[model samples]
Target: MSDGFSSFAKLFSGYYSDKLGKRKEIATFGYVATGIFPAIIAISMSWTVVLIGRIFGWMGRGIRGPPLDAILAKSIQEKGFRKAFGMHRAGDTLGAMVGPALAFVLVIRIGIRDIIWLAMIPGISLQ
Candidate 1:
């Protein structure tokens, strides 16, 4: 993957997501794409396909990040920006804390493929 494309895609996606005022939608789309792309990568045999999927997945993150922050800001209002951001960070860290446990469970019980499929649930529900 090219660093240039990744950076550019993320920069533009963040710009557009902000411009469009669709923060929630962007956040939901990012989640769904993340879930689906990993599955695509797992199923693919070719390196090219896996690379493309990874690139797209990163782009999907670009698509989501600003909008997710934007929504959180809006939800909390301008005066609460600091608190809102703090809450977001806290929630993110909490998720990070659980990730390893979840991965272990997936590897031992359901497998990676199932985990990928399961990931979609949050995205789909968020949407």
Candidate 2:
């Protein structure tokens, strides 16, 4: 499942992002998926459901990475490219740092299944 997700994400996300010119959407989707899927897993009583959610979430992330970088690069000034990329990278890392801890808490309180619904938070903003 992991391998399948990895392969699918790499190819499909890139393709769709390019075709749609929606890298930002991909990135947003990726983040939302991360937020929601783990929450679902934390809430879910079954491992099978968690696995399914993880696969879907991972694919969103995989699709998001390249297009995000590209879009971010395009959106910024050439002279400030380094700084811009740096800030984005930093923010992404920070989000990663916070997400797991938050997930831990959310899972403890609400379980993983319900937590997955939170993924819609960012996704909603995207539209």
Candidate 3:
């Protein structure tokens, strides 16, 4: 599953991030990958295509995790780490809640495929 690939990607991505010293670029690439891949499923006509898209999307998420955390830690002072992380987590939680709620509403109006495409808009715009 995607989790397995994600775990594999995490192990190597951390090493590459350190070597490349380009956390921002790496994270951006990861975010773009995560954003674009799942949207591929919207065009899929088969379950296999859906599976591939999901796996790649999740791997992208895993790829971004460590580098993004490193960037976050570096951006904030040591004393403010707790608050910064709290706020970051709060934003993530809000997104998690809002995304599903929006999807639930939109799915009725736009249907599942269109909703997935709509979801990609925000993800791709993160850059």
Candidate 4:
């Protein structure tokens, strides 16, 4: 369900990023949305709020990807594209692995809501 929103958002966001030539700003909006929404879920007491937050958060994730790639592609020289993208992908993969593991450990210690709050810290820094 969230994926549907994400998929649609990715298509439109990518189109606008190109049309506006504002990859950085669009990407920043994505990061802010992704960050803030989960924190919204943390404070909310209703399942509907959680559902809304999750859908928007996933859409934020979708919104960032293409513009980020566009920024990376623009910034790097052709000769170093492989290396640069590889490093970017590596960092993403590392985060994917580490985030859940860290959350799993933190959930046992601090609880799930706190973990979600903590997750917002890094995202906030992106802005």
Candidate 5:
């Protein structure tokens, strides 16, 4: 359902980042924006709020993706570019795997409120 936002954000945000010459700032904002609303989702008292937060969070990711990719490509050597991107993909996949497993364990022990807060650590660190 939110895939549309991701697609649009990927396109437009990439354009915006390129035009503004603020790759770092835009990328960081996108990443930080993603980090924030999960906590909001965790704490929100209503479904509407959850949905809104979810949309915004996905948008941030869409915005962040292209800038990060551009920066990453620029930072690496041509010969090792594939390797660098492969590593980046692997890290992203690993985080996806680890995050849910960690959350499952933590949710059982610490409860939702606390787990959500604990889950927010890396996002805050990213910001």
Candidate 6:
């Protein structure tokens, strides 16, 4: 459900990025906002608060995607989009793989609740 709204938000985000010529501003803000969502969820005592956090996080992720794509495309004209995006996707996949691997190791020491803080490290760097 969070992703559903996020998917919808992506369209508008892409449009606004192009329309405003502010991809850097919009995407930077999205990264910062998305980073904070997990902390919000971890801190929430009520499911309602968690739900709100999820929605905002999803929207931030959605908003971040397209402009980043556009920026990547624009920045790498020499190599062409196919190569650049391919490398970008590889890194994304690597992160996805590494995240779980790290979690699997750290979960033993930290447990799942505290693992949320681990997720925040990369997210917090976006700001």
Misplaced by over 4 Å in model 4 are none
The regions of model 3 sitting more than 4 angstroms off are none
What TM-score against the true fold does each predicted structure earn? 0.77, 0.68, 0.93, 0.94, 0.92, 0.90
Clashing pairs in 1: none
Q: Which portions of model 6 miss their true places by more than 4 Å?
A: none
TM match of model 1 to true structure? 0.77
Q: After superposition, how far is residue 123 of candidate 1 from its true place, in Å?
A: 2.2
Model 2 sits at a Cα RMSD from the real structure of 3.4
Computed on alpha carbons, the lDDT of every model, listed in order, comes to 0.72, 0.74, 0.88, 0.91, 0.85, 0.86
- Cα lDDT over the full model 3: 0.88
Model 4 C-alpha lDDT per residue in residues 12-110, reported as the tens digit of each score: 889999999999999898898888889889998999999999999999989998999999999989999999999999999999999999899889999
The superposed Cα distance between candidate 4 and the true structure at residue 69, in angstroms, equals 0.5
Residue 122's lDDT in candidate 2: 70
What tens digits encode model 1's per-residue C-alpha lDDT throughout 7-79? Answer: 6666765787788876677777777776567766777789898788777766666667777776676677678
Candidate 6 displacement at residue 109 in angstroms: 1.1
lDDT, model 1, position 70: 68
What is the RMSD, in Å, between candidate 6 and the native fold over all Cα? Answer: 1.5
Candidate 6 lDDT for residue 45: 93
Q: Rank the candidates by lDDT, best first.
A: 4, 3, 6, 5, 2, 1
> Which portions of model 1 miss their true places by more than 4 Å?
2-7
- List the candidate 5 regions with Cα displacement exceeding 4 Å: none
Task: Point out the higher-scoring one by lDDT: 1 or 5.
Answer: 5
Candidate 5 collision pairs: none
Q: For residues 4-118, could you state the per-residue lDDT of candidate 5 as single tens digits? A: 8878899988998899988888999888888887888888999897888788888888989999999998998899998999999999999999988988988888898787677
Better of 2 and 5 by lDDT: 5
